[model samples]
Target: MGTRKFQGIYQLHYEEAMGKIQTGDLLFCSGSYLVSELIKKASNSFMSHVAFLFEWYDRVLVFESVESMGVRIVPLLHYMTNYKNTGKKYNGGLFIARHEKLIDSYFDQTLLKNMIRTGIDSLNRNYDQTEIIRILTRIKLGVGKHKEDNYEYICSEFVDYCFQQIGVRFPRTMEGFIYPEHIAADSNVYPMFEIVS
Candidate 1:
């Protein structure tokens, strides 16, 4: 309904914007929901969620972990349309970032295949509620240990794990804690585009 931009980032129409997204790009979303609000507050960031993108059988799929649906891959269109279908006023837009160094210097067909396979293998994993709690706790206390287990993962953690499979590492303060803002702010990842519909 209204235009909003951060640091001169422009919002484009969602349908026309899909062409800009490429495989292995990171998507940071400022969702419209109570949980999203809490995440934004706790993380001190505009983005509340993050997902990894890949082209699967000609369809762009986003790999992410959410409390409602653990780790899973869904069509990118589905992700963009979810809030619209709910008939709720959603203000959050989707922001995309790509690892230019990885794409230009390291990415190849085999590595891409391995990344997809690794993401697929992680399907059905549970969302790490404990990690979320820990993050909140850390935010409150201003200090805490970063710990995570393989049993489950949070959104950014899942993305980090997938990239690690292909020998790429995103910035992480600790072994297990990775926030959406961390990935968004990483120097290696270049902001490509944003979409709001």
Candidate 2:
């Protein structure tokens, strides 16, 4: 396999990045929040969160599931300048990544619409707390072969499930748990821009 690099520290203004961003793009962050650190530790990667992008009538929105609020949509500008209505930029590196094959190439309007619709449907769904606990427990205890069924999802898994609507499958390690690092490591995903605080 050819070696690949994570996103660099070079900075780009959020306005410009958002203007150029396409629907079905990705956002990644290395947040310093306590939960974020735990995810980084679990995945052994610097990135703690993964979210998808959606373009809606001159607005760019982020589709994500957070521990505090579960699946929700936030304006792209929320991270660029103020985060969670705070007067400061979000606490970490914000990145825009593109899927080489699926974004503007292989995916058709039908698939794209289906993918986006699935993501929209997940709005207000609770973050999968049970799966997260199992993940952390397995991470610390080294247990394997655990699985269950549920409609709730963590951030990365939520994105993965949405992509499945378009027939794209990401790596699901540890009994179908998809992490932010797993999405980052995808061969088709490449960094396009970054916003450093």
Candidate 3:
């Protein structure tokens, strides 16, 4: 049999993909730890976490909101190769997706810079610990509307909020529901490369 593709696209070594990244790119991760597994199961998606990216001079930086460390920025290389300063590659798949809609004429350098600045300003924001529980409870109870608080965020919410800053809304139309799956399901978002860690 042919080698199985990661999310329907051939995987590439981390080094091979590093140079092709751009600002506004989306990073989707399928983590394997206990909390990762729980999040994936709860969301019914292989992707448990998501982050936004922007290039800084020469390095690409990942902006994300993680449980242990709220909103923060780190070089993309450090994140994929030596995750969390552990001196080891990340323990799961990491892929990049591009927004075809915004990458067009609609989104210009000004918006890109503004979005990057917004992400930078969001650093140190509180991570909403109750977010997972609330999302799970809403899902289980079939709640249609989700009230939102931008002050604190889960991973995906942070990504959404940053993109929303530039007036580029997520494709998911469901009221108050934005997650890894929803972002990946956006018709304009397409897989570009996967890290062969």
Candidate 1 residue lDDT tens string, 1-76: 0112234586777777777777888888887778999987777777888898887677888899888778987777
TM-score of each: 0.86, 0.91, 0.89
Best by TM-score: 2
lDDT of 2 by residue, 80-139 (tens): 777888877888878888877565564587888898888888899998888888888778
After superposing candidate 3, which stretches have Cα over 4 Å from the reference?
Answer: 1-6, 143-145, 171-175
* lDDT digits (tens) for residues 74-192 of candidate 3: 88888666888899888888889888856687556787777888888889998887776668777788665555875888888888888877776774426576678778767767888
| lDDT preference between candidates 1 and 3, better one | 3
lDDT of each: 0.76, 0.80, 0.78
Best by lDDT: 2
Worst 10 residues of 3 by lDDT: 1-10
Ranking by TM-score: 2, 3, 1
Clashes of each: 0, 0, 0
TM accuracy, model 2: 0.91
